[model samples]
Target chain A: MQLFFFKSINLSSMEVFFDENESYHIIKVMRKKKGDIIKATDGNGILLEIKITSIKSNKLIGLLLKKMNIKANKHSPDIGICIPKKTSRFEWFIEKATEIGIRNIYPIISHNTEKKKINYDRCKKIIKMAAKQSNNFYLPEIKNISIFKDFVVKKQKGFIANCSNIDSKKFNEIKLYNNPLFLVGPEGDFSDFEIEFAKKNGYVSINFGKQILRSETAAIYICSICNNANNFNL
Target chain B: MQLFFFKSINLSSMEVFFDENESYHIIKVMRKKKGDIIKATDGNGILLEIKITSIKSNKLIGLLLKKMNIKANKHSPDIGICIPKKTSRFEWFIEKATEIGIRNIYPIISHNTEKKKINYDRCKKIIKMAAKQSNNFYLPEIKNISIFKDFVVKKQKGFIANCSNIDSKKFNEIKLYNNPLFLVGPEGDFSDFEIEFAKKNGYVSINFGKQILRSETAAIYICSICNNANNFNL
Candidate 1:
């Protein structure tokens, strides 16, 4: 089933209207006509089974047959990863992280981080697309870039992923808490000073074994592990 | 330290030679000169630290200063994922699986699989690139595509990832054996017949929680879990 995302819309009513772009997509792109059933989401944990009632010149109206509210996953961890210098890599991280059920993503800037500027709007679009594609109604919150020091200080408990020789704890051994955050460094890795600062502020050093994964790969791997550990309650 | 991949080389002696492409990269691209130290791998669990001795017109000669053998990760899982119709997604899976450590990859063809043809040579190149980039000397063995039924009979253990409502076991609860192979379906997913056959033939159905993930993301997620679970011996 294909899902389309609509933002800033009240879906509580029985009938709803789609904007110009979504209307064109439904009528022309998808070749959907009257009485066609479609799955749509409001990017806020709501899934609607809609029936096309009418198609106008610039708008399309649909009647909601059923609504399913997916409860937000409280166990999903918060991921604070340094944005890589390459835009595509960071975008790929965002897409995979959204698909893997991350609660929040904080793009941090460290001393060794090469990329400083980020296109926040483009990242939001990627996250929205991935969320819709993955059948996730709740979009992962994307926070503004923060300094490494400032972000570490705010976190009460979590692990900082780094490959330095600091006798870092293995990820599986750590006990996860609700809304726990994991911090991943840039390609060059966090500077020694940054790691020390994080360690002093109650952040445990965690290593992903012997493999030297890229910054984006590390973030996605950690997010996947956290998702599995928390959602394994089933 | 950056590691470069050199195929089919002898590291027993104190001196070694680089092929034309590697020579050009070292001498022209990297602007490396004599006495420069570099790290290189043979893609077969051998890491060599060498110092450049001379730069010939077509080749570069280097004297080995140190040699280290990275033991193969016996815990990495064997991934049997269907080759997705989109080449990029399948290629992305190959690259990430290599970085996260997979002993072997079997590209299977099922009833619902859209794409049938696969370029084995191209996939090998991708695995090599990813292995070298991640500092993994043991390159994953990429097998040719096989029929779905034929592939399922050979594996007695391991789990098949699917979303059907059949009380699939959670990944964390399963006891992972050595070199376990995980079967991930294509975009349309394995047909009902395929799923039933797999279940009847001793393959446990496993679910990665409620979120619907893409085929590639699911493969990487499973690989990450297996890597963490098996390598946590520390």
Candidate 2:
């Protein structure tokens, strides 16, 4: 089934309206018309089975036949990673994380982080596109840029991926009881002081493997492991 | 230490010459002078430490100081995956697989595969760049496109990743003795006939997780798992 995404619409109501852009996609591109049924999502865990009712000048009106609210995946990770200096790499990370079922993403500005600014809207668009492509009902929330120290103090039981040779446990070795958050450093990795501070704040240091992975690779590897571990029941 | 990649260079000899492009990069972009030391790789498990002797119009002469030969990672996976229709995605897969320590890559032309012809030279360049960036000594050999049935008959103990509802083991559940190969399908997945034929020829079916993953994502997941499992010594 082909899926479409919508934003800021009330999914609870029986009637839904598609604005100009979506209308163009539905009527002009997809050639969908009245009485045609299509699958649509609002990026809020709601999947709608909608039937087109009418087409106004440049708008689309659809009646909802069914609304399915998908429950959040309990095993998704809340990933806090230092934004890379390269924009494309960071955007690629967002796309993959969304497909792998991440719960939330926090772009942390650590001591070694070179990129501080992020295009939030563009990131959100990428996330939405990935979710629709992968059939994910819920969109992972992209948080604001966060300071390393302030973000590290958050009360969450998680592990920080670092390369500091501190005899840290392998990611799979730890027992996960909740949706754990993982912190991945930037290209140069976290400074020694940042590692010490994170350790002092109850963040357990963890290593992926022998090969030194790039920042985006580390984030995806962590998310993949978490997703695999969580899907044992399925 | 910064690493540079050079092709067709003799590592055992005392003198090494850089061609026009490399000389331009070293002289203009990086601004290295004579007597400066640099690390270079031959993309065949050889790392060379050389000191610049002289600079000509568009060439660089260097004297070899030390030579280091890196052994191939015994745990690297020998992966056979269908080439995705999108060139960028296929290129991205090659880059990630090289970083994750894949020994060989076979582009299989399965029934559902869309792209048949690949730019072998471009693919090789991408692999070399990734190996240099990740500090990998050995470069993965990219094989030519092979037909599905002909490729399936080759005697190899491996698993095939598919979305079929048949009973399949998780990637980590199986024990890997030698460097095992993994077959990933295209966007449409393998045809039922292809899967049956592969199973008849000794390929076991394996699943990544509950979610539907893209072709490249599945490949990376499989490689990451194999890397982690084989790195028990580390």
Indicate which candidate wins on DockQ.
1
- What is candidate 1's lDDT per residue for B1-234, written digit by digit as tens? 767755444457667777787788778978889999998887778888888888879588888888898777666888888889899888888999999889989998988888998888889888977887787878899987899999998775668898775767877778888788789988877888888889888988887777778889999998898889866763
Tens digit of per-residue lDDT, candidate 2, span A1-234: 667765435557678777687788788888988999988887777888888888888688888888788766677888899999889889988998888788899999999898899999999989977887777877899998899999988744578898766858877577765678889999888888888888889888887654567888888887777777766745
**What stretches of model 2 exceed 4 Å from their correct place?**
A6-27, A42-44, A48-71, B1-75, B167-177
Tens-digit lDDT track of model 1 for A86-183: 99889989999999888889999999888888898999989988987787878899998899988888875778999885768877778887778899
TM-score of each: 0.89, 0.84
Q: Highest lDDT: give the candidate number.
A: 1
For all candidates, state DockQ relative to the true structure: 0.68, 0.42
Model 1 chain A, TM-score vs. native: 0.91
Give residue B76's lDDT in candidate 2 (0 to 100): 79
> For each candidate, what is the lDDT?
0.83, 0.81
